[model samples]
Structures are given as structure tokens and as C-alpha cells.
Target: MREVFQAELKSIGDELIQMSKLVAEAMERAYASFETADTDIAQEVIAADQRIDYLQNSLDERAIDVLALQGPVASDLRMIVGSLRMSASLERMGDLARHIAQLTRLRYPNQVAPARLVDTFKEMARLDIKIAHKVTQLLETRDLTIASEIIALNTSVDKLHASVFRAVAEAEWAESAPVTADATLTSRYFERYADHGVSVARKVNYLVTGEWDPELSAALDQD
Candidate 1:
């Protein structure tokens, strides 16, 4: 019975890793579509979100079953609870990517970011993609160092998000109202995506260390 329970736990961990990889891919493709105004790729990302959602539901059911049947305690219990939290964050990340793709689709021929703010949005997208991949690595390796790196990347993304607002608020800003709205919404999606990555990293840190680091908590609070 004990061996079987251990196997079940390992299965749950494997599922989380799979979800992470899918999220990274979704973000990559979403950005590609956003960068080029490729509706087809954006459609692909929007459809792919369903798969991530399915995985989250399936993983949650399995975790609940383990809790009901095996009655995990101590570290085992922590693993189950933490897995649930991470899965929720991963699912939200997938949704954020879908939101980005949807915005691209809505704008069609026109680009989402105005010419003046294009470089800023591009940088934010780049950071978001990096943060997603780093999240996958952190889940696979459980290396606390990777979690720290994820937090740092998220910090940079936050700065970029703020810069977008500043640009929009300037008196010289000449973009139309629609462009301004798109900029605000798209920048927010990128910022929230990175924020979810940080949330997952915090959960992983707690799972590994058995206690949350004060510095990590502070960084997330600043978000």
C-alpha cells in the first residue's frame, strides 16, 4: 500500500511538469502570433488552452483522490496541497497567454502596441517567455536557485509593465483610444503572467524548504 501511494505521488509530480511545458509552449506561440499578427497561430494558442485546463482538472481530481484514500501527512500532505496550488497558478498562466493571443486576433492587421511603445511591449514579451521556461526548469529540478531567478525575472517584467503606463500617460502620447486600451490590457496580461510564475515559484520554494523565505515573500508582495 505504501509503495502504491508513493507511485501515485510521483504521478502527480509528473503531471505538473507536463502542464508547465505546455504553458511555456503556449506563451511562445502566443508571442509569435502577437509579434507577427498571425491570426492562425493565435487561434492555435487559444485552442491549446483547453488542454491545459483539462490537465488542471484531471490533476486536481487525482490529488483529491489521494487525500481521500491515502490520507497523506507531513511532507506527503504538503506535496499534495502544494501541487494543487501550483496547478492553479499554471492554469492561470495558460489563460493569460490565451488572452494575449485573443488580443492579437482582435486587432487583426494592426499591431497591438503603438509604434512608440512597440519596443517596450517586445521587451515585456521576451521577459515573460523567459520566465515561463524558467518556471518549467524549476519544477523539474526543484532547484531553489531557479526559483530565485524566476523571482528576479518577474521583477524586471513588473518594471516594464510600469513603463508602459508611464508612456501612455505622457502628454505627447498620440495614439488613439483603442490603441491605448490595447496597450494597457496587453501589458497587464504580460505582467500578470509573470506574476503567476512567481506564485508557482513561491509554492515550490515552500515545498522544498518546508518554510517560506522572507525575502521571497517580500518580493511577491511588492508585485
Candidate 2:
């Protein structure tokens, strides 16, 4: 029974890594569609979110079954609980990617970011994609160093997100209201996506260290 329980725990960890890979793919395609105004790729990203959602649900159910049947205690209980939280964050990351793709689809042939802000949004997208990939690596390796890198990238994303709002607020801003709206929303989507990456990283940190870092918690609270 103990061996079977350990196998179940490992399976849950494997599922999390799988979810992280899907999220990374979604963000990559979402950014591609956003940058090029490719509705087809955007549609693909939107469609793929369902699979991410399904994985989250399946992982959660399996977790509950383990809790009910095995009655995990101490560290095992923490792992299962932490898995549930990490899965929730991963699912939210997928939704944020889909939101980016949806915004691209809504704008159609027109680019989402205005010309003045395109570079900024591009940088944000780049960081977000990198963070997603790093998040997958963190989960797979459980390397706290990777988690720290993810948190640092998320900080950069927050700075970019603020810069977008500042640009929109400038009196010299000449973009149409719709363009402004799209820029604001798209910047937010990228920021939140990075934030969720930090969240998963934090959970992984906690699971590995058996204690949450106050500094990481404060970083998230500031956002």
C-alpha cells in the first residue's frame, strides 16, 4: 500500500509537469498570434486551453481520491495540498494565455499593441514566454534556483505592465480609444500571466523547502 501511495504521488507530480508544458505552448502561440495578428494561431491557443483545463480537473480529482483513500499525513499531506494549489495557478496561467489570444482574435487584422507601445508589449510577451518555460523546468527539477529566476522575471513583467499604463496616460498619447483599450488589456494579460508563473514557483518553493519565503510572499502582495 505504501508503494502504491508513492506511485500515486509521483503521478500527480508528472501531471503538473505536463500542465506546465501545455501552458508554455499556449503562451508561445498566443504571443505569436498577438504579434502577427494571426487569428488562426489565436484560435488554436483558445482551443488548447480546454485541454489545460481538463488536465487540471483530472489532477484535482485524483488528488481528492488519494486524500480519501490514503489519508496522507505530514509531508505527504503538504505535497497533495501544494499540488492542488499549483495546479490552480497553472490553470489560471492557461486562461491568461487564452485571454491574450482572444484579444488578438477580437482585433482581427489590426495589431493588438499600438505602434508606440509595441516594443514594450513585445518585451513583456518575451519575458512571459521565458517565465513559462522556466516554470516547467522548476516543476520538473524542483530546483529552487529556477524558482528564484521565475520570480525575478515576474518582477520585470510588473515593471513593463506599469510602463504601459504610464504611456497610455501621457498627454502626447494619440492612439484611438480602442487601441488604448487593447494595449491596456493586453499588457494586463501578460502581467497576470507572469504573476501566475510566480505563484506556481512559490508553491514549488514551499513544497521543496517546507516553508514559504517571506520575501516572495511580499513580492506577490505588492502586486
Candidate 3:
């Protein structure tokens, strides 16, 4: 029975790893579409989100089955619960990527962001891609250090988001309201994407250590 349970846990973990990688790829392609006004890439990211959603739903069912049959205790129980929440965070990250892609689709043949802010948006996209990969690593290795690194990376995304707001608010700002709205919303989507990555890492930390990090808890509380 113990051997069977271990196998089941490994299967769920593997699925989680796969989901994170797919989301990371989606983030990459979505940004590429945004940067180059590639409608095809945007549509690919949008279409891929459905697969991530299906994985999350399937993971949830398996997790509940484990809880029902195995009656997991202590860390085993934590792993089950944490996997469910982490899957949720991953799903949300995919949604954010889809939103970015949708923005690209909506403004195809023309850039989604203003000309001046294109570089900043590019940097935001790059950071999210990095964060997504880190989450995938953390899922496999359960390295708490990566979790801290993810939080630090999220801080960078938050700073970039703030810069977008500042640029839009400046007196010298000359972009149209629609352009400004796109910039604001795009920045927001990237920031939220990073936040979900951090959230998943935190859940993994809790699953391993069996105790919540005070800092992570406080940060999540603010969210």
C-alpha cells in the first residue's frame, strides 16, 4: 500500500512539473507575439491555456482520491493539499499569459504597447519567463532556495509594473488613452504572472518544511 501511494504521489508531482513547463513556454510565446505582433503565436498561447486547465482539473481529482483512499498524514497530507493549490497557481499563471496573448491578438499588425514602453514590457516578459522556469525546477527539486529566488524575481516584476504606472502618469506622457490602458493592463498581467509563480513556490516550501514562512505568509496576505 505504501509503495502504491508513493507512486501515486510521484505521478501527481510529475503532472505538476509538466504543467509548469507548458505555462513557461506559453509565457515565452505570448511575449514573443506581443513583441512582434505575431497573431499566430498569440493564438497558440490562447489555445494552449485549455490544456493547462485540463491538467489542473485532473490533478485535483487525483489529489482528492489520494486523500480519500490513503488518508495521508503529516507531510503526505501537506503534499496533497499543496499540490492542489500549486496547480491552481499554475493555472492562473497560464491565464495571465493567455490574457497577454489576447491583448496581442486584439492589437495585431500594430504593437500592443506604446513605442517608448516596448523595452520595459520586453524586460517584464523576460523576467516572467525566468520565473516560470524556476517554478518548474522548484517543483522537481523542492529547493526552498529557489522559492526565495522566485520572491526576489517577483519584486523585480513589481518594480517594473510601478515604472509603467509612473510613465503613464507623467506630465510629459503623450500616448492616447487606449495605448495607456494597454500598457497598464499588460504590465498588470505580467506582475500577476510573477506573483502566481511565487505563490506556487511558497506552497512547495510549506509542503516540504511543514511550516509556513512568515515572510511568504505576510506577502500572500497582502495579495
What is the C-alpha local distance difference test score of candidate 3? 0.90
Question: TM-score for model 3?
Answer: 0.96
Which regions in candidate 1 have their CA more than 4 angstroms from the true location? 221-223
Q: What are the per-model numbers of colliding residue pairs?
A: 0, 0, 0
RMSD of 2: 1.0
User: Model 2, which residues run further than 4 Å from truth?
Assistant: none
Kindly report which residue pairs in candidate 1 clash with one another.
Answer: none
Please, what are the lDDT tens digits per residue for candidate 3 over residues 99-128? 999999998888998888989999999999
User: What's the TM-score of each model vs. the native?
Assistant: 0.96, 0.97, 0.96
lDDT at residue 119 of model 3 (Cα atoms): 91
Which lDDT values do the candidates have, in the order given? Answer: 0.91, 0.91, 0.90
Q: Write the per-residue lDDT of candidate 1 for residues 9-77, one digit (tens) a residue.
A: 999999999999999899999989998999999999999999999999999999999999999999999
**If both were scored by lDDT, which would come out higher, candidate 1 or candidate 3?**
1
Tens-digit lDDT track of model 2 for 105-206? 998988888889889988998998899899989988998999889889988999989998889889999999989888888888898888888888888889
Q: For candidate 1, which ten residues in a row score worst on lDDT?
A: 214-223
